[model samples]
Target: MRLKVIIPVVLISLSAGVLAFTKLGLSDDPPGRYEVIMNLVGQMLKEGHYQPKPIDDAFSKEAFNKYLRSLDVEKKFFLKSDIDRLAPLSTHIDDELKGAQLDCFRNINTIIKQRVAEASAIYPAILSQPFDFTKEESVVLDVDKVEFPADSVARYEAWRKMLKYRTLEKLTDLQETRDKSREDSVKNKTDQQLEAEARDKVKKVYDRYFERIKNRQDDNDRFSLYVNAITTTMDPHTDYFPPDEKRQFEEQMAGKFFGIGAGLKEEDGKIKVLSIITGSPSWKEGHLKVNDVIQKVAQGDKEAVDITGYPVEDAVKLIRGNKGTTVKLTVKSVDGTVKVISIVRDEIIQEETFAKSAVINGTHKIGYIYLPEFYSDFNDRNGARCAADVAKEVAKLKAEKVEGIILDLRFNGGGSLPEVVEMAGLFIPEGPVVQVRSRGGDAIVLRDRDKSVQYDGPLAIMVNEYSASASEILAAAMQDYKRAVIIGSQQTFGKGTVQRLFSLDDFYPVKDGQSLGALKLTQQKFYRANGGSTQLKGVSSDIVLPDPYYEVSERKDSDALAWDEIPKSNYEIWSNPVNTDNLKKNSEKRMANSAAFKLLNENLATLKKLEKQESYSLNLATYKAEQKVNTAALKRYDAVNDKVKELNITSMKVDLDKIGSDTTKIARNKDWLKARTKDIYLDEAVNVMNDLIAQTLPKMQRKQQ
Candidate 1:
């Protein structure tokens, strides 16, 4: 199944590097900022990257093609003629990196601008006319499955089919709503009127889509994309972060930001609210709600800017500013009422991204900890960190007298390396956590140093294909020590590389307050304590689950680094190990008898089958038939856990006391507890915890306690 899970791969990065760009830094002639950054990044990747690929003709060709795809991934903007026009300069990118003029990027950028303008007119004209639903045609949604349009006529046909498909989608949804709604106005509409309305809506959506593309995506944004295409050709994780993007990445790593606390998404060309953070400005203001369409954003008394077709990131930039500053939003509610709301932005702590604990009570009381990421804030000495937060959670769970503990690292993308080492030490005795190797340098083992074990009871870690970098390191360490039973997908996301951000200004200083962005370069590789790299081969689970994201992984990316091995670090296994064989057999038997799991396995197969069938029919009747079958199949397995019996779970008394009388926090905590009530994975994890308690208990207490 293609789940489309967007998660960070690996982020164990150092902020600074050795002064290796001395010659490139102090050149007499300081070039433009873009050229300076390009040369600086090239030198850093070549000299500082853990395993640098040769910057030669072959690499240039790949980077050239990658940049083209990045510009028009859908193959809609560029034609066969455009690719042919740019073909001659494809192998000259390396020359540009080696002090030549950047002709390739300049030419490609110019052509894309022209094509984007051309395609803008194409979509509106196509949507103006009525489509014949009687025409039976199929469109391949996957870009790799189709080639660029041969000429302008073919391009127009492509746009027609695409617009028709979009119109059909809206028409079907409108039909479904009319059939289900009780209101007389919607229920009485005829098919012909509905089709026209759908076409109009599609046209409006494309109008805004093109408007944003034509206006907001500037030359700098396109340049960043080109830089990323080059860096990612070296490895998927390495990237070029412009200043604002770098700040956003740091905020994500810290699990907080200064904003109105509303999560936004671009839907039908409108910026809509997805969620609101608890105890933040929007939550306190209480006007902004889910699905509210934000039309304009103003800074206090300043004139408002129309943000109707603004991308989510652009809207966010307009909304968020210095703390205590007022940002006004003009919102359109779902009921069609429009109102202007003003809110003073503040520090929004995303507690949802932090470590939280819940007690799962069945035959035994088990503590569950969900760590969204390996978050850390090095900038603030007193800032919240995952290691300290998880330690606090563990202490609370201990006070609750839970029998066993389960650590869920399912979607943790990873953060600071040192923090993960300390977090891993909380489980096992002082030992090696992970190994790191620089370019042509000996492997260095990062050790915990502490001899104390915080939790010696039965332990288990939950992982999936999205458990990457630091998550893999922790899981691999615990598994190597035989401390925790790894359970979830077949293996975790295999991102075993370390990266560091190098500020371009450090390498090439420019005058007049010019700011050059930073490069997040891959500087090292990660290995488990057992010496096997986690690069392409991630840590395997002791008990595998029927995961729906089987196809989403690092291995799928052609540019991912290769897996290798190093000498095993000196360490000792846990003196007491969990009997994984018994746990595996027990889990297998439980799954074998589960009807939910049976349905899940069947649904997975169906999803796999549907995922392979990429082409979709545009004819109304045929499309409806296909969607009806597919939708029903998915509906049967969607939220499968909701069908299972709810497991008894609750928050600790200390947590309740800490959250006392804060209505929003209290309600959010309750919702958090309620969400996991019927989680199939957690349900079985609770069962495994019960079995472990039974297996480890003393002879007398086995039956009594």
Candidate 2:
């Protein structure tokens, strides 16, 4: 995250019910509040975005389609006729963004409200009749695989197929239970009886879902949706934070959430799990994952609330509660399996987030350091910083007489920019770590001023798709300097663009000081010291280990900034560099022969196939047969690389003493080490370290002689 400036930005055009502000003072009556927000956001994006695309017909078409998708992702509500009527505004959106008229969003808002009413009546009516499970029909849940219905009749049929798919899904589960359970309540149920029950369950869920949609479809909600669509079209990171979200951002609920420790994002009106904080409740629970769709949230034994179509901030509010309180989440996994996960709310343990190291004993004494995120407390100057903690950890590992060190940045999503520059300094001599280029400015090098090197040993940095920004900066610097062996996923998370929030309130004065919300604008881009921008093409690893979650990387998104290069910064490579070609060759040979890697790759392929399987058969036998293959594949992949061989990992005596009598920290420390013990990547990293150590030993012997 980049440092944000909250000052008022007096741009060319600003308006609302209030007087319009431009070079020529107060203009006549402008369009309503919706148009005003769009214009301001449009102006700000053009002014601040690193590579702002012209808001032409292409941008308008993309924005228009994205907004419709965001509105009804399932293709359940709007008919093709509705879309056809609204199609003219698709090209007109560019005009709307420039303050011509907000007919696109305004008209869509009117149509979506009417369609929601129509859908409310359609689903239950379809569920009223019994579905024929023996029918040889299938339904595709993926909206891209299907199109909007042509008319009211086609819309009703579409509704029926979707409901039938849900009913078929429930029926399969019920049948499975009936076949396995010995209890008469379940055992005595007939096939017909189970089908009826499935419909009942489907109806129950849709009932709550529709009720939620009706409650949340106010004018403000629709406008927020429209504004967000416009912002996100520029890039995935650029976003419009409505008033509630802005409040949460100001409150910094990200650090001190009193709920399950899973971060969520609103994707096409569906709340999807973004990242689960390590050592948090969700991570410890081990059920919630990175891409799970949260269907509903329930507290205690009360009725569950359908969170679909609800903004992420609202869903988060439902999830957060008093510590120790239980929040049951009904989530659908990426494999199309749905289940309820109960997680207790707890505050994040601060120590768990700090840099921690352990000794890995083998042929070569190696040190393993885990830094979850590059954390820093902005308010307190004396507060914890990752650079300081990592320096201390390196020192600890140095005391242990470690031959080499491995810094695990696998899941680090980046933090303070200053911290990364300083952390990069720890390994190599004073140099430029990363380059930053603001919109309409020359690229400036951010350097580590201190000439002192902290740990000059056989160093290896581990990364995955989750690593980003500051993590990429450090990794890229090390890779460019040939200071460390880069290992893990194909590339790091390419979130190179820097973002800052601009206050809409600063632009427009509100009565009673009510919030006008803020827009998170991408103002800068990051470049590696080698001149290549780590924009869409992230820092590629020296050794590419296949990551199962590779689909979640930045390149998967169409709107990510394109990869570009600048003039390379002047710097010296490491004086004594490890032979990377030999190291890579040896590692590749090991992975090629390893059974675990082979099976893991095979299972990744299986999952990829299953991911593309959005179509489900309505026939019970056919559906069950297809799901059986999916279930088997998912189960195999679940524990594919659970453990290769547990490594001899132990905590440092000093760190153990620091834990002292604190049972909570002691327990957490145990869990932390226990998780890494089975890590195949870490295991391979140690092997790679041994190779580097082998390569370095002869040189050391020659030096001593």
The superposed Cα distance between candidate 1 and the true structure at residue 667, in angstroms, equals: 2.9
Q: What is the C-alpha lDDT of each candidate?
A: 0.85, 0.82
lDDT string, candidate 1, 273-331, tens digits: 98887678998999999999999999999999998788899898789777899999999
For all predicted structures, in order, the TM-scores are 0.91, 0.81
- Candidate 1 has its poorest 10 consecutive residues by lDDT at 1-10
On residues 327-434, what C-alpha lDDT tens digit does candidate 2 reach at each position?
999999999999999998887544566788999999889999999887765544666788998999999999999999999999898867778888999998888999
RMSD of 2: 8.1
Q: Using lDDT, give the best candidate's number.
A: 1
Among all windows of ten consecutive residues in candidate 2, which has the lowest summed lDDT?
11-20
Clashing pairs in 2: none
Q: Tell me the spans in candidate 2 whose CA falls farther than 4 Å from its real position.
A: 1-36, 215-217, 247-354, 379-384, 653-669
